[model samples]
Target chain A: MNKFREGGWHILLLLICLVLLLPVVFMISNSFKTLQDSYHSMLQIIPLHPTFSNYTTLGRQIDLLRLIWNTFFMAAIVTLGKLITGLFAAYAFKYFSFKGKKWIYLIFVSTIFVPFTVIMIPNYLVISKINLLNTAPGVALPQMCDATGIMLFLKAMDKIPKSLIESLKIDGISSHMILKDIIIPILRPSIISIGAIFFINSWNEYVWPTLILKDKSSFTLPLALQNYISSEGGTNFPLAMALSTIMIIVPLFIYLIFQRYILNSISNSGLK
Target chain B: MNSSGSKNKFLTIAYLSPTAVILLVFMVIPILYTLYLSFFDWNLISPTKNFVGLENYTSIFTDSVNRKVLLNTIVYILLLLILNFIIPYFISLIVKFFINKMKNSYKIIFFIPSLFSLVVGAMLFSWIMNPISGPVAFLMRHFGVALPNWTNSSAMAIVMLCLITNWKVFGYNFVLLLTGLGSIPQNIIDATKIDSIPRWKMVRDIVLPLNKSIAFYVLILTIVQGLQYVFTPISVITQGGPYYGSSNIFYHTYLNAFVLYKTGNASALAVITFLVFLILLYLEMKFVEGRMGNCE
Candidate 1:
């Protein structure tokens, strides 16, 4: 009876897993099919006459490499910018005693409560006025005011004992030297985890990029994918899937390599 | 000593300024600017700004279509709360019950979809639900059944949007709930076992009460992020239509600003959405506090 029950539960779990994995599986398989094959063999998991024609067509239609490069560059710069700002802000909150410290910290953390929609228009106006629209810096700069990153680093910094910092201070070390020599090394794991998160978020961001970027050459991968879906590849299932598959491939690899850190940061922050 | 005291003050300001300036210019200023713009009548392209205090707010309240957009926004949030929070909470419970040594692997697999960009997931579903050459149609044909045009039908499109949102988000919530469950004290479970308390009763009395904070956190987040979550799917899949069937306030706001050049109206809507979120957040905090107080 015990073995039977366990076996049944396993089967149930497997079925649930299959349902979850179905779309991902379908996307990869269909991306390999010819357009005609995709239409005919819709339900089939594997294409009978699989071909790479869809991918080749996608390459001809858009500058795939340039789009990917734009996405990577933006994500990298935003991640680095967020880390620097987050660290300094967190250091101040963690190490210093000052007037209105709690209030200042609260103000920073409370930005999370203000949804992006509430600030979208004015942010657009600001970016446009500064003539940063349709530029990579335009897409990245507004995003660097990251409350989540600051909060995460603050929490991580709190875990490091004050005695250590005090000891370094007594040894004639300046605050900057303490940050460089003591804090950075101890917080390396958290730095990497938070950096991965910021990178993935900026990479996958659609709404801001859609609004800010206008030039075809400046389009992020998500915008490129949206453009394909809406205009270029209308009702062309194989081509759309091919473009989506390519979009997923880069982040998919990053997620695979940094799965542990990514999941850690997500579960820790509990903010999506 | 005086120099050192002054130096400390200067250093503190220096450390905090970079983040503070960015937040002020980008976040604080824009939020205030949005509120300020709500009272003005200015096209985004116009050089002159005309102050039209309360007119934009009045129009959204009076307009019939905008009213429906408001209603749809509320409905979308409530539906998302149920689908995203309630269903996932129970699913996490079930997974926790049956999970064994392979729990970590199950978690990673579930989160795979969430790792993909929202637009990518939305486009993939656009293909999967494609009426003429999609999998749903293909499967229905095999069963000698018919599937409605999922994204085109008025009644089904919003529900379909809800389901897709749930699919992308379910894993993230599941992981959160799983962590919540893991935090339950082992000794309490062992103690409950000693009493031979019925399993369901024990879970109700012990597990649920202990997990209240995380459950509440999940609920609050579902409400807060719910509006933004549906935007991508609506835009990509339905364009908020087969004649405004799935349009919510967020999509409506986007339409006003970008498509129609109604900057003042969009600003008003944005402010209204923010106000609604604040009210909801206050209510949730009160409810959670009341529940915890009762438990104590």
Candidate 2:
């Protein structure tokens, strides 16, 4: 009887998740439809006659390879940049005492609340001045240091024992070595999860990349979709859906693989 | 301030320099520059910034379209709070307590939408909800349902945008609430069960208070950061169209600077946004620091 009730609850949860994710279902199903079929089969959760033509057509219209490369490379740079910078800054905050430390730490973490528009105009000017406009590095540069990475690192760093660090210090270990040998191994799980988050965020970033990456060659995956969705509304629906389907693959992969780490990080961070 | 050894201060500064430099160049300087630019008129390409004192601020206040955008921003905030935070909170509680099996699967499944960009969500919904050709409308037609064109009306436009963000982000807040619920002590819940307390009452008296911190974090995230997620969808779907019916303060600022080349007005709006967020964030940081404990 109890098992039956549990099964019923599972059905209920499945129904709710389906309704919530209906758009995603629609997107995936429609990506396999033909252009004419896309218009007609709007109600169907599955394509009547699925085809790969939309992808072939989309690939011909845009440089799909370059765009994917741009997005993947940019996300990688952003992930690594954020991890290194955040790890260093968080290390300083955790291990050292310095003037204006509290205020500085607060300021670093408070960048979470800094509205994006407030900085874009000046960042644009600076990017243009530095000749990084229309470059992958330009898109990656302004985004390299969000507050979540810093905060995540700080939270993870809090767990390492002070006595462990003090013993290392007494053994005449360099700060870099202490961080490398002791702190980092313990933090591997957190670093992977946080890095996944940073990567996924960078992959899906649109607004900042839209500002920096003007050339189609430098366009990220999200920016590439905007081209099909021109200023005037002559949208190529099936092709657009096909491209979106492709764009979703990496993030879904990361989520599936690192879900445990990500969930734990989120819950652990939230609890405190 | 010094650590156990005085010499390590240099190492502290060394460790801190990269973040300091990045934040200064990217966050601090841009904010100050925006404030300075807000005082003067510049076309972004012009050789000289024409100093115009408080003219930019005055125009943003006096302009009718701008006022509508401000009103739209407030509507978006309230609607977003409903769709993104409150709805997700309740749903999370339901999933946690009512669903006894595969709760983690539900979380993982729900979060799938959040993995996709809002650009995709906008496109998908715009097609799915297309009044003439959309599935929703096509189904509605059989029932003799007359659907209002949401993009045509400011109120519905804001609501629709908020819903898109909700779809993209609902799982995130839901999972957060679930996490909060999970953190409630088993003993407390077991005690409630022993007393035969009603489920709703248990949720109200025991569960809600226990999850206050996570709920607060979710609230701040939805408020301070939520609408920016709506930006891509706005640009993609409506472009704040039907006479700027759906434009928020941030989107309006973008149009002003990027489209109209009115750098001064955009800068002024940016400054105002910065000040507003700064105050809210100040309080949040104080709360967080209180919990995290004061200086190391």
Score chain B of each candidate by TM-score.
0.91, 0.93
For residues B154-191, what per-residue lDDT tens digits would candidate 2 score against the true structure?
77777778888888888877877788888788999899
Error of 1 at B220 (Å): 1.6
The CAPRI category of model 1 is: medium
Give the chain B TM-score achieved by candidate 2.
Answer: 0.93
Deviation in angstroms for B12 in model 2?
Answer: 0.8
Candidate 1, residues B1-296, lDDT tens digits: the string is 78877888999999999888988988888888889999999888988889999999999999998998888887888899999898778767766654455678878988887777888777877777666566787888889987777666656888888777887887888888887787788899789879988656877888888888778878877877767888888877788887777999999999888888989999999999888877866665565553221100
The candidate scoring highest on lDDT is 2
lDDT of candidates 1 onward, in order: 0.81, 0.83
Error of 2 at A213 (Å): 1.3
Worst 10 residues of 1 chain A by lDDT: A227-236
Task: Indicate which candidate wins on DockQ.
Answer: 2
lDDT of 2 by residue, A1-272 (tens): 75776677678678868877777777788889987887777767788998999999987888889989999999998899999988888888888877888888777777866889999999999999999998888899999757666677888877888888988888889999988988899999999999988898899999999889888888999988877764344577778889999999999999889998887776655555
TM-score for all predictions? 0.94, 0.94
RMSD of each: 3.2, 2.4
Error of 1 at B2 (Å): 3.5
Residue-level lDDT of model 1, residues A1-272, one tens digit each, is: 64676577668667767877788888889889887777877667879998999989989999889988999998998999999988987888887778888778766766766677788898888899899998889999888867777777876776688888877777768999988988999999889888987888798888889789999999999888786675112567778788888878776888788898778777766521
Candidate 1 versus truth, CA RMSD in Å, comes to 3.2
The TM-score of predicted model 1 comes to 0.94
